[model samples]
Target: MNAPYADPSVTAKTVSARISPIGGLDVLSRNEVARLRGASGSGLHALLRRCALAVLTSGNISDDPRAILEQYPDFDIQVLQQDRGMKIELSNAPAQAFVDGQIIRGINELLVAVVRDIVYVSTQLEQIGFDLDASAALTQSVFEILRNARILKPQVDPNLVVCWGGHSISREEYDYTKLVGYQLGLRGLDICTGCGPGAMKGPMKGATISHAKQRRRHNRYIGITEPGIIAAESPNPIVNHLVIMPDIEKRLEAFVRLGHGIIVFPGGVGTAEEILYLLGILLHPDNASTPFPLIFTGPRQSAAYFEQIDRFLRLSLGDEVARHYQIVVDNPETVARMMIKGLEKVRHNRLDTKDAFFFNWALQIPLEFQQPFRPTHEAMRALQIYHERPRHELAADLRRAFSGIVAGNVKEEGIQAIEQHGPFAIDGDADIMRALDKLLQAFVDQHRMKLPGGTAYVPCYRVLSA
Candidate 1:
């Protein structure tokens, strides 16, 4: 049940209650429960608290990583062990997550997901000694996580389309995403995204309506995210299947490995990071024959946005990079149709290669792409962005550059670092730096750097052009 905020110290509405696991997790061992309840330095409680709070406060529209925590300081969650399995107790939880004293079913499921992933990653992966440092093992880790979550369906066809875009976007751009999603859903295609608001939510929202109209049953709206990103951008309501990977690298790998194709919407640095990450993988000599479909689309009014992205990409990765993706403007049906055709190619390729429909085992991802990038000030400054390097390698560093900016902009650790030390200093080739500056400046001008309700966006990085 919901309750009024009685504590003068606390400002947001809250409710205190005990909720049982709905779906995501059913039971936990005594040892697992102890780790979850442990509040010490090595314990999982802090991580659980952050992720669970994000799930409880889902649909909150704030990019500030600490907004929810600050607003509800008293909020706490604990996994209570019982002979009947386990029960979750919440103290001063978000009131919006409940209705008439019962937790919102969807929020409960997501909350359970937060716990499940935290426990699984801590107990299973780490205990199993998965060599996260190696590329193949990292891929195996991702596969195991997805399989544990029961997201990888064996009988399904190659119809999952991974949509990459920003949570901060224009109204028109957001609407365009919905339209494209509706078209995709009508054609029996599902969607997977970062699971935040704006572009992430729009596609899933549109797909729901179309799925209902077509009487589509068991349609999947998968949202894959990591701990750092989830803290800033909470999962949207439309996501029925939520999987929180260990980090952003695993999250990105989850997208490419699980989905059949990808669609890019107009977005800021985070979206750029995704684009470069994918293009880097596709550009690899080993993956040239892989038939992964990638398309960039937006409203007619936002054509210039995609044009800027196209220019920056060509300038940074060379014109040959354009062969990996197509830019389709203002046409939702065409995007869906093209995506359908692309999935056909993916299906045929998988059949010939004898690969599983749920996971793209045939695609080769480099170790550089799999490794976790800390995005520290030193790391950002040390990136080699000159044209002297191989194009794929250059793309990897470029992706890291944008990732650091994203961390500084919304992630708690990145923001703290940026506040303690000034903006990250990024210097590369003169031409690349200039283009990067122009693209970032355009993002700032368009108010695509952060959500509108937050404080004005101060750039988190400086482009040092030669």
Candidate 2:
């Protein structure tokens, strides 16, 4: 069979097919099915179409969120309620997701995850009217979503290592991520990432081979993501478990709660945001004694990248923040070894505190960290990046600042806001702002702001010198 059409701009082919539910979704009620098919302003149909298309085009390398939609303009999806279960009808979907007229098995499972998460969040979570204002409630909501997806295993030991890095990175840096992941897998450690390409994909790709050699059965490659960024960063093919949170805050929280430790690789503003989020939570007086292992590493050539990140963190949050994490360069074995030792401490801490291995209940995440931040111009400008405030509070606002830049860089809503209101305006103390400007400029100069082959990179936020 031939594709119905191939767009010259995207140079991609499309197909249409009906697939049975594979992984998470069982049997949705008729009302649930209708809500998924709904087309109203509040309906989930549009969200479903965009996400389902993203899943079908898994392993796509483009960073532009709208590229897939533009390529498959006529793509649509519908959920049909049947006696036994449900069926998904995909129209004008990406041809790569199918082979010889049948959808790829992995892709099929991911598509089911997309549906399962959407329905669970909208109908079950939202309909219950969760009090988003309360910190505990929000965390519980994240736990419920993950538990519903069967991502949280009570019997499993703490082996999941959450890897964070840029989707756009140099070949050398990417290979380094794989080497680190391969070492971790040889030690029987599992991998969890943001589920995109570049650094996110590299680790999982490398770990698969080592896992095969170790004969590690039921090895978990978890990909945790949110709705806003999934289209831009599709789930990499190696991800065996996929869980989608409702928003970025929850998404970050899910990572900290689920993974035993974290590995930081070379990345852009998004990576900085993750660093700040974790450090801020750890710096809180209540969590000061909690041992969460965090390491920043890259290839030998990328030493300066981590140096700039270290400078920015010290200048903005204070030199004391350095105590929270370590920096290791050009050593994959040492990185894995350190992470394994760190996990041992994490295990002992969990035991002493009586915390569940599946979840980190002892960590105190302030409301500021858990709350969803909307990166509108006004909100971005109003952030208080000052030195007088407490270190953790200052870290929270700084995290939001980088988070806004991330929104402007790749998120759809942030891009639209930037187009309408120009670059976001960030103001702070002169020294901190200067350090931030230099760091972001380095990202631009090194092509960390956007993936290669896109248009010339442009600044999305202006650092107003104080």
For this target, which candidate reaches the highest lDDT against the unseen true structure?
A: 1
Give the per-residue Cα lDDT of candidate 1 at 336.
Answer: 97
lDDT of 1 at 357: 96
Model 2, backbone clash pairs (residues 3+ apart or across chains), number: 0
Q: Per-residue lDDT for 1-466 in model 1, tens only?
A: 2223345554447787777788767788888888899844566898899999999889988899898899888888899887876789888888899887788998988988888888899989988898778888999999999999989999988999999999999899999999999999999999999999999999998899899999999999999999998988999998999999999999999999999999999999999999999999999999999999999999998899999999999999999999999999999999999999999999999999999999999999999999999988999999999999999999999999999999999999999999999999999999999999999999999988998876788999999973
Roughly what TM-score does model 1 have, to 2 decimal places?
0.97
Taking the tens digit of each residue's C-alpha lDDT, what string does model 2 give over 226-341? 98999999999999899888899999999999999999999999998999999999999999889999999999999999999998888888888999999999999999999999
What TM-score would you give candidate 2 relative to the actual structure? 0.97
Candidate 1 has which clashing residue pairs, if any? 1-101
Question: Can you list the residue pairs that collide in candidate 2?
Answer: none
Candidate 1: stretches off by over 4 Å: 1-12, 39-41
Q: Poorest 10 consecutive residues of model 2 by lDDT?
A: 1-10
